[model samples]
Target chain A: MSRSALGLAGSLGTTLQRELQLAFSSPGRIVNPLMFFVIAVSMFPLGGRMSAEVLGTIAAGVIWVTALLAVMLSMESLFRSDFDDGSLEQLLLSPQPLYFHLQVKVLAHWLVTGLPLVVISPLLGLLLHLPEAGYGPLMLGLLLGTPALSMIAAIGTALTVGLARSGLLLAVLVLPLSIPVLVFGAGLVDTALNGLPLTGVVAVLAALLVLAGTLAPLAIGAALRISVH
Target chain B: MLTVANLGCERDERVLFDHLSFSVANGMLLQIQGANGSGKTTLLRILAGLNSDYTGEVLWRGQNCRQTRQEYQQALFYLGHAPAINRTLTPLQNLRWFCGLQGFSDDAAIHAALQQLGLAGYADIPCHQMSAGQQRRVSLARLSLSAAPLWIMDEPFTALDKQGVAELEARVDAHVTSGGAVILTTHHALQTRHLLTVVNLDALRTESA
Candidate 1:
């Protein structure tokens, strides 16, 4: 590509690297959400006196809900520091489209936080006595579904990033948007365990991801500009 | 060139400034003068197209800035009131990321700019360890590295000592001499012996009132 194009790619790559660096440098940024996901998932068994069969019945829903909440827990931090330090102004002033850079940020967030939840879902599945067949579908659903959660949560994060107490508002704004992903993801495991063809629900989850990927950046970019103002 | 036609802003039902108009041509400096909370930073942000809650037009190169945001932003650099430095990152790392966001990257140029800002040995050290003025230098280092023609800085002189302030004034003078334009807000009396236009917001506030 030409010089400017190369610069755009380099900028995205550098942003992704910085996101990872920040997340790792402050271990709490990554660890807190992961712990929340694991602890929240593990709590279902403790709180309920259900047998393995009944637990298996609710495992998919529990895991999916916990993952959604874990992702939400990490959302407020997405743009908070950037907004506080005036880097959001720098990003807005950048020649590159804010859409592209914002997406890179969301993608990196998913990779750091959401991907870990997906990677460890099978172990969580075992703890919840999720059926053997449910593990594959659970991991698959999370892998395909969580990007949309991150992208949707990004818009809410951007909107509330300027607020001093944004956690409740973020959940209020984002949780509704995430319901479809939760439904499709949690249902995917049930379909797989019953030996039903999973393409329909899988396609729905994939479509949600694609739609979020395409449209969220626009909302995110607008929200960021408003927040900066 | 940058032009504003009857620009105005209000915050929390209070009029900050109204019917503000000014222009800065190539090789000129416009200083926004006002006391604290007189909306100097708000005016600069409106000019930089960061704040949209304004009435009237901000024309960059004879076109509405919002209409051609990409081209407009490409030629514009904005430094806000707060120094936009990440405390966890080293000065070098911060510059590298800033340059990358500006759609370029060069380690040598970043280091040289840091050195010019008197941050020679603090390149690898995290910003939290540096003094407030040292961290401010890291933010100001971008001015030396950036080639954007229009520099909009809000309180660029903050946290700098006397010598550092003088050095920054010289740099701004050089920038104007090289056919670049600047709009900035400062409490310090700038030593720029050039085509300087002062937009006293305090006077404008009374006029609008």
Candidate 2:
């Protein structure tokens, strides 16, 4: 690898490793979001009948909403620990591009918080009596969509990171931005259930992911600088 | 070289300091002294290019620091009031990650710096298991590991034992002797015999008031 590539690889590898270590070392941090997703989704079924028709009617919407909340629940943590402990200061001082590092952080957060949801969606889909055909759309949609959710949530996380308690404020700031993701994610299953072509919905989501992957990091980087200052 | 001219800052509609100006060149140690709430930390933050809400020019090598941010940051090392230590990670892991964030990773050098900071046997132990001073030492280990020409430290002596304080002072002194520059804030008196310059923000505060 070239010098710049080596540097990028080294920094990216270490940061991802650090994020994973930090998340896993505290089992609560890793478990809380997953549990929140499971519990939140499970509550929906208990609130109503066990009929496949009723469960399937709500599963797409319920799972998407719960997944959104799960990501938001873990969102405050994206920058909170660093901001509180002064590592954020060091991050701002780093010679490497803040945009790149911030992107790495968003990716790490999705891995620990959003990836599990994607992996377990089929099980939840089954629990919710979702149509077998809907399972593919649900999993693929989340796989493409959650990263965007994470990136958008990161903007709010960075904006409010300096505040002592910003969880609610972060949700308020981010939820509006998350509407597009939620619409398309749930719409994926909805389209499949309707026997319509799902490409248009997935295409939009992929575009969103790409757009978020390219742009959100810059906003997140700028927002973190403002908050820290 | 770092230079500030006619700087002014206000917080929550209260003037923290105004018309403050100072400069630090290679081989110099400029200690910023001030009472509580006197803006020593804020001043250092401005100089380090972390805080830009102030009014004035912070010039690096005769150019605006903002325009030359990448180069400026490349040559700068800042230690904030907090040690930036993560409780879950060992000192060695923290240092390695910190260096990696700066775009390099050297395990041997990280170990050596930890050893130099009197943390040889404590390298692999998680920071939560260590005393506050030892945690502070882990942050201080970055001092020996960094080759940045400009060091901006805020209250670096906090939680240090007498020997740790002495050792850090010696490190700062050696840094200046080696043609690096340092801007630091400390309530504790710095005993460095290097080319020391003092910028007391308290006097600036009172003068502006």
| Model 2 alpha-carbon drift over 4 Å, by segment | A1-6
TM-scores for all predictions: 0.97, 0.97
lDDT of 1 by residue, B72-143 (tens): 988998999878888888888788778888778778888888888878888989888999999999999998
Record all residue pairs in model 2 with backbone atoms less than 3 Å apart, i.e. clashing. Answer: none
TM-score of chain B of each: 0.97, 0.96
- lDDT of each residue in A90-162, candidate 1, tens digit only: 8888887788899999999898899999999999999989989889889999999999999999999999998
Error of 1 at A115 (Å): 0.6
Off by over 4 Å in 1: A1-5
Query: Lowest lDDT 10-mer window, candidate 2 chain A?
Result: A1-10
lDDT of each: 0.89, 0.89
lDDT of 2 by residue, B41-88 (tens): 898899988899999899999999999999999899999998999988
Calculate DockQ per candidate and list them.
Answer: 0.56, 0.57
Span of 10 residues, lowest total lDDT, candidate 1 chain B = B101-110
